[model samples]
Target: MRGVVMHAPGDVRTEELEMPVILEPTDAIIRVTATCICGSDLWPYRGAEAIRAGGQRMGHEYIGVVESVGGEVARIRPGDHVVGSFVASDNTCEICAAGYQSRCVHQVMMGSVGTQAQYARIPLADGTLVVTPGELPADLIPSLLAASDVLGTGWFAAVAAEAGPGKTVAVVGDGAVGLLGVLAAKQLGAERVIAMSRHADRQALARRFGATDIVTERGEEGAARIKELTGGLGAHSTIEAVGTQESMEQAIRATRAGGHVGFVGVSHDVALDGAEVFFSSVHLHGGPAPVRRFLPELVDLIFQRRIDPGAVFDLTLSIEDAAEGYRAMDERRATKVLLTTD
Candidate 1:
């Protein structure tokens, strides 16, 4: 099988690799139908995160057909079309029962397994994989794939931010996740959605996704703009989809007192001021999104064609061109890139 490997920062290649098999009783193997590059992948690609001694496998988001299942797997069976969370969890743990599957006791980080390939192994199959209602049309595949991670993460951000009817929500990033966060906020009944973005294209898409306003300014200015838009009280809720010192601070500062801030961006070197947060009076709740908790609902939404989260993937490439997909994202030429295994 061929898979994507990162030899070093800025060096991604498609290489022939050994096929994965069901190594655990709960494991399942799938023939990857589609996978995509993630913003988090750029951390290692840009040298912000250190790579291991050996080449690192890339990608976590995937949707595929089950090739085989281990003896313990029950709900998921071979030949099932499935989508799974980026973090594989037993789904039966106490933490998972509490709806935090991302931190499941027996969690497996799928990034280490690399779904950007022809085939891959999925741990905790019965708990991690969600089978679609039936065979899906080709057009719905991209949206279903998005549900595996970005859509679920964005939805989680919106939920954590407490977005609901009559709430004024502000999103602090314009990436795919951020853009989808806008969609999630609107879907969750936010009366007004403000998208902070400098890019015209992203702003247009944000509007299409239900962003009632756009703020091009970033950092303090962005926060000030958000406050100004809300008559100096700030937004009722804020979603921080970019994990940065500036973005995080902006999100906190842009939210009103007693509001909520749901941060889902992979934190890099972010540091917070104790005094500021202490005074902000905002509820902060977010981490690796428990995508598994929302997979079933999101998959149903995709199956019903209620949301087109796949619009974020402006670029698509064959798996062999995975390097170019990475480059396009790094260069800001594409909002998101989808890599096809076929």
Candidate 2:
């Protein structure tokens, strides 16, 4: 089998590797059909985070056909077209019962779980894999695959910030995560959506995803613009999709007093002043994003054609060309990159 491995920073490679097989009772082996590079994966790609030396499989978002299943993995079986959530959770834990499967007691992150491989061994099959409606329609695969991560993450961000009817919602950042946040907010019923974006393509997509306004400003200017748009009080809700100090401050400042701030970007040296954030009366929440929790709903919406978040993907590549895909995204030449294995 072949898989993607990032031996070190800026050294991602496609190489032959051992195939994954069921190693636990709740496990299943999937013949991957599609996979994608995520913004989160960029942290290690850019040396912001340590890349595990050796053959560390890269990628997390994916959907596939079940190739084999353990005896205990009765919920799914071979030949089933499915979308695998990034978090492997039992779906019966206390946190899962409360609709937070990303925090499930026995959760396994699929980033290390490695969907970039030709074959992936998915633990907790019953909890992680969502069978698509019958055999997957060819056109539906991309949308279904997005539900595994980005779509789910965006939905969680919207839900966390309590986006709804007549609420003024602002999204911080213009990456795939942030653009999708605009889509999720609109679907959640936000009356007006504002996206902070300097990129023309991303801002254009943001509008296509339901963002009503695009702010090109940064830092205090951006925050003030959001407030100005909201008549000087700021938006009622803000989604922080960039985990940097500037993005965090932009989210906090754009949100009005007592407003909610949902941040999903992986934090990087962010130090929020309790006193300052407190005085602003902002409620902070977000982490790895309980992606599994939103899986069912997001999948259903996709199947029904209520949303097409997959449109965020502007570049496609064979798994072998994934390194170029990543480079394209890092250099802002692509909004999001999709990799195909089959």
What overall lDDT goes with each candidate model? 0.94, 0.88
Q: Model 1: per-residue lDDT, tens digit, 1-342?
A: 999999999999999999998899999999999999999999999999988778999999999999999999999989999999999999998999999999999999999899999999999999999999888689998898898889999999999999999999999999999999999999999999999999999999999989999899999999999999999999999999999999999999999999999999988889899999999999999999999999998888888888999999999999999999999999999989999998
Candidate number of the best lDDT: 1
Candidate 1: misplaced stretches above 4 Å?
none
**Per-residue lDDT of candidate 2, residues 1-342 (tens digit):** 878898877788888888887789899999998899998888888889988756578888889999999989888989998887788888888998998888889999898878897899888899888887887777877788888888888878888888899999999988888888999999999999999999888889999999998999998999999999999999998999989999999899999998889899989999998898889998888988888888878889998988989898899899999889889988889878888886
TM for candidate 1 is 0.99
Write down the TM-score of every candidate. 0.99, 0.98
Q: Show where candidate 2 strays beyond 4 Å.
A: none
Quote the positional error of residue 303 for candidate 1 in Å.
1.1
